[model samples]
Target: MKIKVINKGHHALPEYQTELSAGLDLRAVLSESKVLAPLERVLVPTGLYIELPQGYEAQVRPRSGLAFKHGLSVLNAPGTIDADYRGEIGVLLVNLSNEQFEVKDGERVAQLVIAKHETVEWEPVETLSDTERGAGGYGSTGKK
Candidate 1:
């Protein structure tokens, strides 16, 4: 699906790294390097604006390599960008490791995944249907 986007940053528009990739790498737009101290979090802008059709959303997710190698993560994993939103895309980044992480311009910091969703209306039901594992959650199912 083709999407309409406005890129105000210096870097090129986000693109899929491979043919079968489900997400596009989102680059950081910054004037200077920003240090992320351990256990600290910051909102990093992408200088991008998008116009998504109804029933669709853009998910902001963490880069796996950055999360694994540098203990960096998107604070709000899978942050949702609604179809009606028309503002700069920003990623909430958090440093989960002990060492500091430097965020530079054009650095791949997050992934953007466009997804289609359904809008549900509440039925105001009296009770939900019973299930085999009703009300069982939070590790209620034993691990293998």
Candidate 2:
């Protein structure tokens, strides 16, 4: 599906690194480098605004390499961008390691994944069906 986007940053539009990649890398748009101390979190702008079709949403996710190498991650993992939003894309990044991490202009900081979503309608019911694992949750099954 085609999407309408406006890029005001100095970097190219986000694109998938591989043919079968599900998400596109989103770059940071900053005038200068920004540093994040350990346990620090900041909202990094992408300078990208998008218009998604109804029943779809854009998800901002952390890059695995950054997370593994620098202990950096998205504060709100898989942050959702609703279809109706018209503002620039911003990523909430956090430093989990005990070191300072610097984010430079046009640096790949996050990934954007466009996905289809569904809305639910209320079906007020008095009772629900029963199952073997009816109310069991959170480690209900064996760890092994």
lDDT of each: 0.96, 0.96
Q: Model 1 over residues 1-144: C-alpha lDDT tens digits?
A: 888999999999999999999999999999998999999999999999999999999999999999999999999898999999999999999999999999999999999999999999978988999987789889877654
Q: Which stretches of candidate 2 lie over 4 Å from their true place?
A: none
Taking the tens digit of each residue's C-alpha lDDT, what string does model 2 give over 23-129?
A: 99999999999999999999999999999999999999999999999999999999999999999999999999999999999889999999999999999999999
Which regions of candidate 1 deviate over 4 angstroms? none
How far off is residue 69 in model 2, in Å?
0.4
What's model 1's lDDT at 129?
A: 94
Q: Estimate each model's TM-score.
A: 0.96, 0.97
